[model samples]
Target: MLLTTAAVMSALVLLASGGAWAFTGWASGRLDRIDPFGALGDRPEDGPRGALTFLLVGADDRSGLTREELDRLNLGRDEGGARTDTMMLVHLNRERDAISVVALPRDSWVTIPGHGPAKINAAYSFGGPQLAVQTVERATGVRIDHYAEVNFLGFLRVVDALGGVRICLPEPISDPRSGLQLPAGTHVVDGAGALAYVRTRSTAGGDLDRIDRQQRFISALLEAATDTRTLSDPARFTAFSETVLQTVTVDDGLTGGALLELGNQLRSVSMDDVTFTTVPAAQTDFTAPTGESAVLWDTEAARELFGRISRDEPLAEPSPPAAAQAGGAAEEPAQAAPELIVPPADITVQVRNGAGIQGLGARADEELRAAGFNVPVPADNWVGGTVEQTVVRHAAHRADSARTVAAALPGSRLERAGELGDGVEVVLGPDYQGVRAVEAAAPDSAGSGGIQAATATDNVCA
Candidate 1:
């Protein structure tokens, strides 16, 4: 939830340009820094050029708090190590004129670098921000250009500094651990209440539900923070900046000036320009080999979901399956016109194993041959690790062939890889079922089930 963070970041640009040199000078010292990507080797340089992605982590660390204040806040003993209670991938597509904020469930199962498969959030606990950044980049093939962390106290202070944020409650709820107790209705919650609202997992949908509420709160926070009252007041603006600067911990790439440039890029962005969604998941109560309950993502859908973001493509609502439709009448897709169709035999493909399943690459290669398509031998591993879905990528000139190859492989999504050489490149995800006969088209929608979404302009309720 970047309600306050987004507001602060977006408004910081204005402050930097409005002759707040003294404040900027003061801010340089206030903001903390950590090189989250240091151990990960030289970062990839060819990320989406016109877009920037930041990993915003809400840490549950209670360090640096006086005993008295901790007790007064009802905060229990400091959790020795910090774990991200909330994580969001904030994407700013400068060329596309859109800002996408995607919330990732902490409980989602993923492979940690050193540890085996575990909750995505555990990446932070296993090795702090570096591991967390690595985990996210591997899980979602999108490159993380920046990282930001805010602890419990920092979040509380930010909310308090802004005079609190308004939230609508569906029913009365009380979560002892988070110390959140609220009546059913729309109410403005203070720092503590805001923390509790976002941290509580006792509700119906558990963490998944909390994410929805966080997204809503972010919208409300941005609306209130950017309101005329808050922006027009010189004193309030300065105070808010001080609170944020002291709280947010960013990577080296997000310097004050870099942040201002990011803000400048997003200056034209509005509530209408902001869209929020969660990574698609298959199950929430999946039991890992270690017997720990974790969230299982819908691999195929999740890959396509993040792949689109990596390419700065618009995220549209998912279309329902033909079988799920009334009367089960299949509508042939219009986007796959005859001119856009290429015979499987006429297409050449290079298969890359992104699915972690052993021998999947070889199997996919064999399947492609059986389907009468030319497959390049000796497939390579998708850099980073496994993916959730099989994707067909091609250069701009091979768009029609990519679509044709996609049709041959059921459930595969097509992507344009400008850097790719001739022919289609198939990155098989973990969900690769065998290659099948080219069939009617998949639905035109860009997203699918288990993915929750809301635009800043929407009145989304948890």
Candidate 2:
């Protein structure tokens, strides 16, 4: 899904600026082209003039690889038809300031226009690119402005061209079928190893787990491809872009000149402005009408997700509409939701007994530990007046970590305390609810409360 989009976005980054712009104008002609929309008369209407949405797909078709290549790569028998290994819906806001890459679960149980009920990936397999586009548009209700597909094989070449990518697993991962085996540590993986790493499917969460890996992988890849040294080197940029373009096939409209224009528009997008997430799934083991297992998107949540994109609204909670201006209204600037980049295991918190209930601080400390945060020091008494609302206090620099702490404690308020220094304090109050079962995700508060996003950089205020 994002694997190819990562390459495309990274390519735009390299082509937008630097001396490589003209070179990409020439190289764009080398990109594989397809007319995926010509026959679709019922396409979704064009959205905001300045906004753009791209459907990026990665094909796992093994039919094209030679016998020797398959043997070396451990690719199984060809499935005969084209099925998307991964799919992502990429939205670029009108301002070109933020990008959201939403990974579409290939196993999603969705209706394929004329094909009745089946897994979403089957759309590509049954009707080629046209049906895939139509199916996604029908399901998500968001007009896709452009389309691009990539062969997963290209991922290897690009990674190798960039001299491998560095990734650290907080835990070990092993998949014999894909031949991806790695211990819990940081390592620079080459092309084949990178391929195996992405294609591995031994995780407990199934596709959900793979999506997380893909997110981290794409983020890491983008970081590597956009590294200062890589961009500064013409020879390196050319090779990397060539390898990427070779693997991608876009719709007829995305021409060489169009790509150059896109490059310029996206030049301002920083790593922090880009976010990788998945469509919220209500059920992962849904039994479809066809009696096959499939992922089912939360109908309401998925609709709201797309509707927000359609309105050109920020993925984060929408700021209260600017009080009607004197003469005219103002645009609601994009606010990315707060996302937890650092793992809970890496964060430390000190519980303070402000509630005065017996062993309140100790109970809070134990809950936080079970929730995955580190608490090295024992609980302490707050000694202040009786507290009402629980508060997570930390220095300004640790706001992200503080958010994690606050998020772990439902209804807790996050605050900055100058005296706290490097220490983070969670003062349990009388109103303290039990610790929230957490995940490595942006806090998706119920209702219209502004959406908080977790990003690697916490890119705020441009």
Q: Which candidate number has the best lDDT?
A: 2
Q: How accurate is candidate 2 locally (lDDT)?
A: 0.67
- Span of 10 residues, lowest total lDDT, candidate 1: 320-329
What would the per-residue lDDT of candidate 1 be over residues 106-186, giving only the tens digit for each residue? 788888877978888888888999988888888888889878777667777767878988777744778787778887677
The CA root-mean-square deviation of candidate 2, after full C-alpha superposition on the true structure, stands at 9.6
Q: Given candidate 2, what's the lDDT at residue 202? A: 72
Clashes of 2: 9
> What tens-digit string does per-residue lDDT give for candidate 2 at 1-462?
224434444443443332445336577777778888888877767888889888887766556677787777767666565677667887888887787777788888888999888888888888888888899999888898888877756767778989988765534677778887898567789977777766666754566656656666776677777788788898997788778777677888887777766777777777776765567666778887778888988676677677878877766432222233322322221122255533576466778888889888888888888988878778988866567878777543345557667777777776544333234678889988878766654224445222223332221110
Model 2 misplaced stretches (Cα beyond 4 Å): 1-25, 317-445, 448-453, 456-462
TM-scores for every candidate against the unseen true structure: 0.67, 0.72
Report, for every candidate in turn, its global Cα lDDT versus the true structure: 0.66, 0.67
Candidate 2 at residue 215, lDDT?
63
Clash statistics: count for each candidate: 1, 9
